[model samples]
Target: ARVMVAMEAELQQHPAQGVLVVGDVNSTLAAAVSAKKLHLPLIHVEAGLRSGDRNMPEEINRLATDAITDLFFVTEPSGQEALLREGHPASRIHFVGNVMIDNLFHQIGRLRADPAAGGRGAALRAGLGDRPYGVVTLHRPSNVDHPEQLAGLVGTLRTLASDLPLVFPVHPRTRSNLSRFGIDLGPNIHTTTPLSYMEFLCLWKDAEIILTDSGGLQEESSAVGVRCVTLRDSTERPVTITDGTNILAGTNPARILDVARTALAQPASGKRPLLWDGRAAERILDVIVDSPLFQPV
Candidate 1:
């Protein structure tokens, strides 16, 4: 609501410029409505991705935002197909590839140069100290809101605790849910606050495996050649599964345990590069500049 009001104010103040809205669904929708009202072109990044579950607010956001966007910058060909299925004009959709790929490439050189990156990897190994460990991150409301779901995930983690350390960077919302439900963190499960992007990337790089409910992390884990077990039933990015880098475990304890065990049993192998060549932003800019419809504000 606050975002809507702010966008309305911006539209009222200056209504002639093109506006691009980035981020989650709510912000995208708010920007779209404002852009339409102001007769401005609206661009949506990370467009046309869906988890196929109406229970998730993000699904609604993706659909609603795409409805009003003038330019849809998608990460994958699948996203373009999804937009076409929804009746989005073919000319409006552009597969600019994943911006996160651009981000990762931009940072790789720096990460390699930084002593902290190596030190952090060493520190993670020292902390685990010869014990196998898997990184876990949970933030979805579906899992955290329901006691049964939360308990199921925790139970799976507990079972694996003897063989592997589960490093969980608990989202504050999930933490609150944990307290509300009285879900106890087992001794082998190390819970901590969210890490910075660099810190988290380093951890992901070093982990034997990753179990997550985050779409971005799922992609990142695959990009770094780590095996990922997604806690969600479905994913917007299905390429990870096709590439054999990730498996959807849902919230089923048995499924989660089985998948995690399988992932641990296998030798670590890098996944095929599925994102982009790290020039997505440049490509997007080139396309925009070349397009006849493009007019810089």
Candidate 2:
């Protein structure tokens, strides 16, 4: 693959002591494979996550990348347990918490400091000032690629919109589906093109609730203490549900509506998962320095 070749060339020319890859994307797997083939130590961040759905491409990437990873940096206890069960050495697996949450906190601090930052966020706020709103995002192939399933979700969103204003940052795939399937989001649902990270963070941070099929949003919402309803049936990040304010409603229309309604009615309340205190990157650095892979020969 292109990523593998590029990684190989980069390593051959610059010869790093260790190669680090993050998350379960295709590039992560490619880089992991390249590192192993070149006899370099492969460090994987956000490793050992499993959604148990082999059908998901990301699940496959996680499994394959962890199989050859030398050091595993995990976000949650479940990740550590999953790696242990898969026969990875305990010493190599470090529970360094979620770096994404750290970035979330950083961005939020920036927004708070300025209050006038993020153009789109300010515009959105001006439009919906002093009113409670909800956020919706759907992009998973399991939900959007299939017409029948997508229609069901749209219908349910329409119903929810009648009661609550829903701001949907529609993914390109979802937008195409809307046009192709002739699905109307109804007047109550406001659709916008995808937003910048700060714009999105500003929009969702104070929302009453978020409806999403995204893996990262689930964790971000939980970190911000905002109620979130996951549109997917299974999530790799179970800590969000157990310790944070995330509810799994799957794709079923009735369940999603019921859960979203209940979540909206309740005040957001949840403890941050252990070590999600914006120090995960620091912990990762400490581990790397202490690790044998980085020790002087």
User: What are the lDDT scores of the predictions, listed in order?
Assistant: 0.80, 0.92
lDDT over C-alpha atoms for residue 100 of model 2 = 95
In candidate 2, what are the lDDT values of residues 211-266, reduced to their tens digit?
99999998998887999999998999999999999988989988899888887777
TM-scores vs. true structure, each candidate:
0.91, 0.98
Backbone clash pairs for candidate 2 read none
- Model 2: residue 265 alpha-carbon error in angstroms: 1.8
RMSD of each: 2.5, 0.9
RMSD of 1: 2.5
